[model samples]
Every structure is written in structure tokens, then in C-alpha cells.
Target: MDTKRFISFEGLDYSGKTTQIKRLKEYLEGEGFKVYTIREPGGTKISEKIRRILLDKAHVNMTGRCEIFLYSAARVQLVEEQIIPLLKKGYFILADRYVDSTTAYQGYGRGVDLEMVRLINEAATYGIMPGTTFYLKFLPEQVNKRTKLSGRELDRLEAAGLDFYQRVFQGYEKIAENNKNRFVVIDANQGIEQIHQKIVEVVKKRTLEEL
Candidate 1:
């Protein structure tokens, strides 16, 4: 696989990953690159269904183990059905979440075993890993402020509370530390345009390096 073409964005909800992704997609398109953006736990018919189940607040009883399996199931389907094919066709794939989310949210926040999470992630992705992952760094409190400002209802995961989010935040820090070669930590507190500029610069540099 041409992993260099596969980039992913990771962050807590309300961290501006969606905005950055949109900006990057437009920038890539302007540069004559075909960009394909897809959100995790989604991007296919079966995955979309899994996404709904995973995010539905009504499923509050869902266990962490079940959550892990469902997310992996969605991811495997997406990898085989959409991501792999698009990468083969020379598209720049921008993913809005990936295996890292499970490592942070499920393994750390939900108290699942990290080794188990690692195995599940590897299986789900078919050993496919992104060449670059932009992690938007934000504290749980900052996210809460953003959420309140937006006045949006919380989904199952988003409503996981401050303590849970704190664990996830720390988990992300550890993951980024261990994967420094592939992880780019962006301060989510920056101005939107500043963040976008940084992302564009990094992508441009990586593109050149890969070539």
C-alpha cells in the first residue's frame, strides 16, 4: 500500500478536525490531487450502520468490549471496501479518525487492555497504517467549552465525561510520544487559519519527501 497517500486526523469531538480536513481537502484539490475524505466507523454501507450504533446515545449500555469489536468491524469493512481501493487508484485519503481513537478512547478511557486493543486495531486495519497522522491536541475542559458554545447535543462517546476524556487525552499523548515519526501534534487552541497553514505546510513537505 502507498501509505504516504493515507493521512488521518485524530482528536476529541469539537477539536476542529473536521474544519482542518475540509481546508486540507480543498487545498489538495487545488494542487491537482484527487482527495478522498472519509470518517471512521463509517465510509461504507455496513460501516455507516455500525457508526449509528456506536454513536447512538440510547446504546448507553454498550460495553467497552462490544464497542471495540463494533468499531473494528466497521474499520475492516471500510479498509477492504473503500480505503484500499481508493489508495490503489492514487487518491489522497484523509481519514477523520482511525485505530488511534480506539487505543485512546477504549483502551485508556474505557479501561480496556492496551495489548488487546493493539491486537484488535491491527486486525481491523489489516496492518494498514497511515504515513502521517495529525493529532489535534486539546484538553477535555477546552473541548467542553467548545461543546457548550456550539449548543449541540452530546453523542454516546462525547458524553463520556471529563474524567474519561482526561484518560483518553493522556492516552493520545502516550501514543504520539511512541509514534513520533508518524504523528504530528497540532495545538487545537491555535487560530483556525494558523492550524490550516501548518497542516498545509506539513503535507507539502511530506509529499515532496515521499516523491
Candidate 2:
């Protein structure tokens, strides 16, 4: 096991990041590795409060700058309080989402300045970057299909129209292009078991390389 490695799962809404992260955690634990699973914007108590404000459906009037700041605040708390400490002790950290979400959603999706987004993310993360980021690629139409299948009302971010989501999708592709070494894109339209197996294969390969 690569104890010091940090792995993050990224994708569009309803792209199965939560499910895959859970499975990866279980698989790692079964291999006798200590795993710490954390979600962005809600890892710590203070951050969870911020997450509530950010995700509240009623907050339609929130400004883009405010949204970015709140997310960065939550990320700072999570990294300082939980992520950094755990990594120092050599734990395998699996994050559901991280800095990339901010860059994609707020930066590209909401039209915030991309450089400003990077600055905030760098400050919040304090250079503790994820060693590997698994990006589950799916189209906006697929997102709608999955959302309907789940039978859940969209959150404030998810409620953003298809155009916004397409922008976010493009943003993710660009990020993946620029950071090919750190990103492993998986086609998320496949079966759950197949997707999980592909993720496991990439993770195993990357862990060995890191070691």
C-alpha cells in the first residue's frame, strides 16, 4: 500500500463518484490498508456548516465570488484539520471531491476567473495535492438520465441548466488534458462493476508506481 498517497474522485453530478469512492475504500481496507475517506466542503464541522450554505436550494441569489470563497473556506478547514494530519501519519486518503470541483463548477461553470480559482484552491490546499485523480467522464445528458433514475431533486449546483453543466464538462476535459499524469479518465457510462474494476486497476498500477 502507498500509505502517503492521496486519491480523489472527480466527475459531473450523479457520475458515481460517491459509489466508487466507497467501493475503493472497502477494497483498500480489505487489502489491509488504512483508508481515510473525506468529502469536500464537509469534512470538518465548520466546513459542513459552509457546505450547507453552499448547497442550499434557496441560495439562488448567492454571488459567484461568495460561492468560491465559501468553498475555499471549507477546503481550508478540511485540509488543515483532517487531510494534512492524516497524510502526515501515512494514511491512504480518498477524497470524494476536492479542488477540481471548484475549478470546474465555480470557475468554468459559473464564469469566475480561472486564475483566481486556482489561487484560492492553492491557498486552501497548501500544496498538499492529490497524487491521483480519477475523473469519471459522462455527458450532461447522461447526468440527467442518472439524476432521473435516482429520483432525487437537484441541488442548487445540480439545478444549474444543461449549458452550465456542459461548460463544467469541458472544463474537466481541459484539466485532464493539462494534468494527464495525475488524471485517469474513466468512461462512466459502463456498468457499475466494470467501472469499479477499471478504477481498481488504475489505482493498483499507480500505487505501485508511487512505491
Candidate 3:
């Protein structure tokens, strides 16, 4: 396989994307492949700071336009500070989230202009996209049920109501359809190991000739 590649896992909250990415990273690294993992809105120092301000529950009052812009800004920093450099060094860069999150959560979920969100994300990353993007599909209700935030307060995005998330989920599906070659949809209801196996299957199928 082309071990030197860029990949990403995308989904709504509690879709087990993070866990899957971590496992994939471990698997790749254990096999002597260079692997790097990152989460969107953070990844780099500046981006992480911006992430805190944007996701903090105290920022609930922040305007939707501003929130989207901040996400784009953080993405720009991550691209410059981490992702691009790692890719240049031939690491298989795996991201937990990327522009799709904003495209889904902000554009569709919050009713921002979808085109505008795409433009902002494009400008942020300068069009640095992954070789493949794995999108985990699930219902908003399912995700919320899995979310275990008892005493800890949830952020504004995390606390965003269910109906909004349904729209976001639909947005993800459309985005995946819209970007057919780059996007891969997975039945996220599967167990963690199963999901990982599915990812490996896709990778094997897609990269078989190339690898």
C-alpha cells in the first residue's frame, strides 16, 4: 500500500471517530509506517487555543458567523503549523476532523451559507485535502445517548440541539456524495473493531493497485 498518504476520519460527535483514528494510527505505526494523528480545531498550538475559545460553553453567546470564521482560522493554522509539514515529511497524516465538520455543523446545522463555509475552509487550508476521508454515519439521537457528560458541562456545539444535528448529519452525507472520490461512508453502528476492519478493507480495496 502507499503507506505515505494523508487520511482523515470524519463524523458528528460521539461517532467513535477519535477512537478509530487512534487505533488506525497504532496499527500503522506498529507496522513500521510513519503515522501522524490530529484533531481539527486543534492540532497546532494556535489552533488549539482558538479551539478552546470557540468550543467553550461560555462561548454560547458567540455569533454563528464568528464561530465559523474561528473554525476556519484554526484550520489555517493547523495546515501551516502541522499538517502540511508532516505530509511533506512523508507521514501518513490522519485527522480526526477537518473542513467537513464546519461544513456540516456550521453550514447545515447552524444554517450558515454552505458555499461561504466551503470558501472559508478552502482559504484556510489552501485546498490541502486528504487523499481519503472516512465519514462515520449515525443518527444524532444515537450520538447524544452515547455522550457521557454528567457533571461536565457541554460546549455550545456539543450542546447544540438534536434537530440541528440531524441537518448536520444530512449535510455530511451530501458532502460525501458531492465529493465521491475523496469520501468514503462507513456504517458507524458497527463495533470499534469492526469499524476498524471496515476501514482497512476500504484502504486495501482502494489502494490495492497503488500499494
- Whose TM-score is greatest here? 1
- How does candidate 1 fare on TM-score? 0.98
Model 1 residue 126 CA deviation in Å: 1.0
Pick the winner on lDDT between candidates 1 and 2.
Answer: 1
TM-score of each: 0.98, 0.96, 0.93
Q: Largest lDDT belongs to which candidate? A: 1
Work out how many backbone clashes candidate 1 has: 0
lDDT of 1 at 171: 96
How are the candidates ranked when ordered by lDDT, highest leading? 1, 2, 3
Model 1 residue 102 lDDT score: 97
> In candidate 1, what are the lDDT values of residues 1-211, reduced to their tens digit?
7789899999888899999999999998998899999998899999999999999989999999999999999999999998999999999999999999999999999999999999999999989999899999999999999999999988888888999999999999999999999999999999999999999999989874675
10 residues in a row with least lDDT, candidate 1 = 202-211
Model 3, which residues run further than 4 Å from truth?
1-4, 148-152, 207-211
Residues 147-174 of candidate 2 have per-residue lDDT tens digits of: 8899997889888889999999999999
Q: What would you estimate as the lDDT of candidate 3?
A: 0.84
What local lDDT does model 2 show for residue 180?
95
